[model samples]
Target: MTSLPKTMHAVAATGSVPLDDERALLDVELPLPELRPRDVLVEVAAVSVNPVDVKTRGRRAADAPPFVLGYDAAGTVVAVGSEVSLFAPGDEVFHAGVITRQGTNAEFHAVDERLVGRKPSTLSMAEAAAMPLTTITAWESLFDRFGLRADSTGTLLALAGAGGVGSILTQLARQLTGVTVITTASRPETQDWSRRMGAHHVVDHHGDLAASVLELAPGGVDRVFTPSTTGRVPLFAEIVRPFGSIVAIDEDPDMDLRVLKGKSIAWLWESMFTRGVYETPDMVGQHDLLNAAADLFDDGTLVTTLTHEISGLDAAGLREAHAIVASGRSIGKVVVAR
Candidate 1:
């Protein structure tokens, strides 16, 4: 085995302060991550900022240890644990790590092999990094939560169509199913981006959302996928068909469930980390989905949503990427790469 460094460069959230505060995220040196039986140590080449990172940063306790805050990563494996059989040293892999574990904002990361997948042959590390988290979330929302299939025909209304999760959801739903995809975007660029991602209809979310959707999908939509604006569950209830379903990824503590009771509408939540965090029997399903997505990427059936790229893996670059994601208007994924 090759000798590895004792410590590595990393960026961590040192305090629960605003993004502008220098103490919010800091450059630090941490010991190389310890590997478990199912783990593999990766030399991280790139990472992408997501809304979770911004949320996690603000919610870190005052006295807690500095928390690394990246979920999406693409890197090369440098070593594997005793029971690991999925990958070997020098293999390129990508994954959206579980929230319960340490994050991937470091020169090296240790991740469970069941949660990782082979990096797409056709994509650069940055592009590959931009995908895993959003792809898994979107995949689970459409197929696992809503039970959408290639032959199933219905209209799906995806709120915030140009955001990271929405971007990939649109592509997956359009290319893999017979359903009509209706996505919401307020800006011209975002509207165009939504169409390019395979949305059949792009409605202005700034206008009357229900009216705009009803215009395109009369009789209400069959499914609603909300990555943001989850507080509008009542509005979704009014716009979804009887026996329809709604899946949300954002946190909505005050969301009332009674609104959908009359129509028997199903309300579902898709958390991609649930399996990995709990060590569920189907945890390896992520590996299968990611490998499937990689094939789609290689065959040109799907494309990376990365729109902004920052050079370097230091705290300054991560802060910039986090700021972009926190702005809530970033068109696609913003990545920080080596």
Candidate 2:
């Protein structure tokens, strides 16, 4: 009989360096994980690359020891921990992992059953790998931050960038809410992609974003959404109508907040990792939300946002995937197969 192939392929950094530097990421072997008491072992068939993965690998430190890098995965389970009852060995699952430890950039990875969701039956592994992170961010931002009712028809203005999360956000807001969507993209390619994802209107984020928006919304947009850095925060004061809200997942840059003082507008931040990192009481909300997204996808109310496919589960493949994101040219998620 033939023996099984070794379950040891992994991607990692060999030394501290910038991602643009040559030899920044390297291939290596890692001992396959021994399932923890509450872990479910996933035989990674396909994994997707996100900006977070690139950020973690390029800038995160691991002392002298090497650390594995990856965040989103779609695969089948091969084993389960003693306490895991939600999954079986044959179950196909998907998850975007917690950032405190090593992630899914390997042949096999173990995750707590609480964080993993059954893969949407209607989507392929390459497509399914794109949902978790961006979905959570957009969902939480829509409901938690802007207070945009799922059934509201008020206008939403997405300022700056039209990549993965923005693409998914446009679709969900259009389908699930009473929101008229306008998105900002600096380039023609991004503008076209946003429109394809269902943005009702597209404008350039460069030049005068606020003036451009006001021209359309003399009364101002009901809400403003930003997926890019906080440097653009001040623009919200002029574009959002009085009492409207601005929601962001990007850094809170040094900008004057006094611009919105007269309007009573509020600013909100969405960080998807907050619950898992703090072990919040509602930590399981992530699992529930992702499962809901899966159901929506299977039932045909939603769609996956995969933009590119990079073959191989090795470092070179992963590096190429990372470069796509780092280049700021990626339209959506980039997936790699095992």
Candidate 3:
């Protein structure tokens, strides 16, 4: 094992005490891990702020110091465990870690080799930082949960297409196969960007979402991806072909699911942590899926959707990131440099 660094820095929310001031992220020195055989320690280069981090901060009533929150990391490996053979000390890599552990806001992080993938050679660390969490979500929803054939020629309806996961999914569906991809974005800029990202058609998500989608894909879509919190997007079953699939990442259960019984729609809820949480048989799917994404990136088939960049992993910067996302209309991903 490599000698553990004596001290490292991370943006932390200290104390369980609740106050408006608690939102300020503080720099704190933390001890790096004593490496294990199968683990690799990465020197984080860039990180992205997701909605999960904001939710985590608000949930803590106390000054809960030491809560280092971040999920997505694009960085370079600096040390490896004895059993690790996939990467050496100089490889660039990325991964979105489980929700339970300390996150990627730190200058350094340790991850199991099984959970990480080589960064896309086509992208910089900032661009690669935007891919993992959202891409993992999109990949798992489209491929794993829906079981859509890699070569499926069906139409896919992406709800809130301008958001993080939807932006990536829209392009992935476009670049990977012959799927007729349609996405919803309310703003003018978002609509244009979604089209640029390869959505065959773009519609307003504000009005009756199903009706707007029906306008472009009147023939009926084969897949529905609920990437954002759209209570109405679940009605996509109405626009989807009978027996078509609905893959949802929305945690909110406000939809009238009772309407789907007649269509016999295949509804699936995708969570990237299912395998790591349950130790499922195909837990390594994340590793494989990310590698597949890297390949598409390298081949020029896929594009990076990094729209916004912020500096430092501090609470102020995180607040801005969350505000943009909470407004329900951000195109692509927002990254924060270490």
Candidate 4:
């Protein structure tokens, strides 16, 4: 067995104590995790922040100790648990880990091998790090939830097409499926980015989302994927073609799902962590899709969405990264590379 470092420096949330300070991240030393039967220890090279990270940090329980806060990561495997067989010590891998466990904001992280994939050779660690979480969410939304086929031709509408998940969702619907992707963006830059990502049409969500979409599809769209704010359920109901499906990843506790009844529209939720968080029998599906995404990236069929990046793995850098995400103005993704 290769020797492992005894302790690793990581950016973590300061203990459960409530605070009025703007700073939520702290640099702390934590002992390296002991591996489980199917685990791999990765020497992390890059990590990224998502809305979930900020939400999780905000909801941290009082009296809780420091908590690591990251999900998307790219790194090299340094060791594997006794029962592991998928990867060797020197392999490069990337994954969006299960939310129930410690996160990847450290020098080293232990993740289940089933949740990871071989890194795309064409991408640097930072580029690869920006992919996993968003890619997985987009993939599942299109294929698993909507049952979209690569050869089926129709229209798909993406709400907020320039954000992290929306950016990738637009690309996947365009490149992998036969769908004519129409995405919504409010700014010139966001519209340009969405068009470049392969959207057939870009409409402003700030305007009438339903009108903009109906102008193109006439009837409605075959599927709708929204990764941003979710209060637009009625708008989605108005524009979704009868029997079409609407999938979302955000929480909309106040959403009136009854609007879908008139059209018999399927309103579904996609949580990328459902497989890993529940330890499902199909957990390795994440690994499969990640590898599929890697192939597309390497072949130039899909593009990396890493738009912003920062240096260092310390607390200050993490705080800054989180601030950008919380601002709700960040396009694509914000990464922190060591």
Candidate 5:
């Protein structure tokens, strides 16, 4: 067994504080995690920042203990619970852990075996860390929420295509499905990145989204996905074909979902943590999906989207990563590697 430390360093943010406040996140010491029957202990090698982390930090209560806020992680298994069947000590793995549990900003973390998968052998830990959350969300949104099949032939309109989930979503839609994908990218670099990720067409979100998409699809798109909860519900409604599906991961409190009623469009919300958060009967589906994604990576069907990497697992670095994500200008994923 690998020797374990009694305490580990982790970056955490106190709840309900503004994410832009540097004091919100701090480097702290946490006792090593105790594992559950289905858990595996991982010595975290790398972690990535996602919008969920910023949202979670902002929504936490002001008085709450510094909440560790990260989801995507890649590491080597240092220990495992007695009931863990899928992995053992020394296994290299990656996962987007359950939202109800403490996140993966720590040097060590414990995650349920069902929510984890073996890391793709071709990628480094930092590269693998950039994947789990966005990949799972993209996969779930594309196939599960939209009920899209690999043989499906249609056009998909992906909003904010340069963002973390959108980048991967565009790739999966292009490679896995027969869909002609049109991605929204405002900047020159991001537009290039979207095309490199396999988007058949790249449009500008800063301009008239519906008009841009109409020019590409002629009528409208058969599917739409937006990672951020922007007030683009009406735009999506305008460009989505009748009875088409629209999926999103962000919380849209102000969204008027009724607008889609005329076309009978299907509006779906996808949260990657839903399965683990609810302890659903098919929680193991995360394991299966992650393994399938790893296969895609190994076989060259998928690529890691990590464009920026922070060197240390500390509060300062975490805050920098968070700021980049909050800026909405990051082209791909940003990771913190130790």
Candidate 6:
């Protein structure tokens, strides 16, 4: 095996500073990540920014050491731990690193093999980097949380359909299931993007959300998938069919569950990091789903949602990617590639 470097170039959040702060993100040198028994050390080629990166950066303790803040990554595996069975050195792979571990915003990243998948033969590293995290969240929401299947028939209302998870979720629900996908996009560009992602109907979220949805789905949607749940659970209760489910990606601890009591609506949460963080028995499910998604990409059943790309994997590029994702107006995933 070739000798690996002891340290690598990386970008990290210096503190819980605002995005506008120059110290918010800085280039630093980090020791090459230490690998666990089932881990692989990947030479990261590209990374995509997500809401989690911004949230993690903003909430990091000021006193804490500068921390890496990326999750979705595409790279080539350079080494593997003794117990790793799924990948060998030189394998091109992609994965969303677990939140509990050091993140992927570095020249090299250590990730458990069970959470990694072979990169799609059809996608560039930047394109593949835009997928893993959002893809897993969307897949688990539709298949695991809602139990949607190829034969399942219903209407799905995806809030913020032009966003990362929403973009992919719209395609998965439309292509894999019999559901009529209704997505919310207040802007013309996003509406067009939603349609391109396979949404059967696009409703303006800035308007009367419930009214717009009701017009398209007169009986209320069979399922509602929301990226944000604060101030929206009540709206979900109003537009979801009785006994239907609502899956949320964001955390809303104070949300009132009573609002959905009248209709007995089921409320669920999806955190793609759950299985890896807790080392659940189904942790390998991420690998499986990612491989499935890769096949779909290779076969042209799915397409990359990356709409914005930065030229290099440096602090400036990452900051720009973060800014794009933080703008709340980005129509799809934003990536930074080497």
Which residue pairs collide in model 2, if any? 152-178, 153-178
The CA lDDT of each predicted structure is 0.94, 0.81, 0.79, 0.89, 0.90, 0.93
Candidate 1: what lDDT?
Answer: 0.94
Candidate 3: tens digits of C-alpha lDDT, residues 11-109: 786553332464456667888856768678889998887766666766775645567888889999998999998889989998887777678888888
**Model 4 ranges with Cα > 4 A deviation:** 15-23
lDDT for model 2: 0.81
> Tens-digit lDDT track for model 5 on 1-338?
65798999988888676666776998899999999999999999999999888878877888887778789999999999989899989999999998889999999999999999999999999999999999999999988998889899998888888889988999999899899998889899999999999999999888977788888887788988877656878887788889898888776688898899999999888988899999999999999999999999999999999999999988988988998988878989999999
Task: Note the residue pairs that clash in candidate 4.
Answer: none
Determine the backbone clash count of candidate 1. 0
Candidate numbers, best lDDT first, in rank order:
1, 6, 5, 4, 2, 3
- Candidate 1: give its CA RMSD in angstroms: 0.9
- The lDDT, on a scale of 0 to 1, for candidate 6 is 0.93
Error of 2 at 294 (Å): 1.2
lDDT of 1 by residue, 1-338 (tens): 67999999999897687789988999999999999999999999999999999999988887778988799999999999999999999999999899998899999999999999999999999999999999999999999999999998989999999999999999999999999999999999999999999999999988999999988878999999997745697898889999999998886788898999998999898999999989999999999999999999999999999999999999999999989999888998999999
TM-score for each prediction?
A: 0.99, 0.92, 0.90, 0.96, 0.97, 0.98
Decide which is better by TM-score, 1 or 4: 1
The residue-by-residue lDDT of candidate 2 on 1-338, one tens digit each, is 23334567888765567666545777778777877776888888888888877766766554646788777899998888998888988899998877875788888888777778889999998899888888888888987777667678878987643687888888889888878899988778888888888888898877687788888788999888776755665667777889998887776657777888889998787888888777788877888888989999999888888879888888778878888888977787789887
User: Considering every candidate listed, which one attains the maximal lDDT?
Assistant: 1
Q: Write the per-residue lDDT of candidate 6 for residues 41-64, one digit (tens) a residue.
A: 999999999999998898888888
Between prediction 4 and prediction 5, which has the larger lDDT? 5
215: Cα error in model 1, Å? 1.4
